[model samples]
Target: MSRFEKLSHVIWHCQYHIFWVPKYRYRILTGAVANEVYRCIQIYCGRLGCEIVELNVQPDHVHLLVKVPPKRSISEVLGAVKGRTAIRIFKQFSNLRKKPYWGNSFWAKGYCVDTVGMDAEMVRKYVKYQEQLEKQQEQLQF
Candidate 1:
């Protein structure tokens, strides 16, 4: 295969799992707060030139399935998404302050990311079913 063909044929996809503490996992991601965070993430991901295929925003954590260009490093892509979102979230929702919501940070220290295979259909299915899996877990909890 030609170099251009080789490059064009390759596709890189990743799933990122991120967490945030509500001053210690207090579950502060409610209606408005969650919405704001989601919006910020959308913009941040767009700016980073990554496509957010799916997102599951829970009360304490978030799951994102993103497709990034092969030229971008995983760490750089995650940093852009996480860093920009954190800043925008803190700015838009001041209640995240310690005096209001929490003091120090919006997201936790680290994130989980994994690579997905080139099977596009499988990736699509995984993203689509993520919410159902969460619901099943919730049902089992009670």
Candidate 2:
């Protein structure tokens, strides 16, 4: 009935717009490389229990809209995704190793992440309405 996901202990809805780039910003993510990247993302996210709301693999960058669990920090989620994907990608596409990815790292040093949710005005309105409902409930109980 609710959009919230039920875990063993927590019910939550946390989504993130995550973006990252390849090492040296190269446009090598074309053809087979792109396909492999997509597969790697799907496998890793599935294993981590993170759902992919949407995923776009670009030549030099990637855009992922993912629903992560409350128990996992953003850093932890991204780290697992990025780290394991890099390993899998390189192992599958060994030619990429000769291109620019030194130290066996495919992605760049860091990534960009933003939360996806309601705007401030909506949240403020909801909070105000919630308080009013509580007040009405107290009156009914008396």
Cα RMSD for candidates in order: 14.5, 1.9
Q: Mind giving the per-residue lDDT tens digits that candidate 1 earns over 1-142?
A: 4212124667444444433343356576678877876787788777777677787777877777776666777778767766776677778766566355445566666677777554788878988799889999999999
lDDT of predicted model 1: 0.67
Q: Which parts of model 1 have CA positions greater than 4 angstroms off?
A: 1-23, 118-142
Candidate 2 local lDDT, 1-142, one digit each (tens): 8989999888899999999998888897899989989988999888888999999999999999999999888898889888988888888888778864466788998999999998999999999999999999999999
- lDDT minimum window of 10 residues, candidate 1: 2-11
After superposing all C-alphas onto the true structure, candidate 1 shows an RMSD in angstroms of: 14.5
TM-score of 1: 0.63
Highest TM-score: which candidate? 2
Local distance difference test, each candidate: 0.67, 0.90
Q: Total backbone clashes of model 2?
A: 0
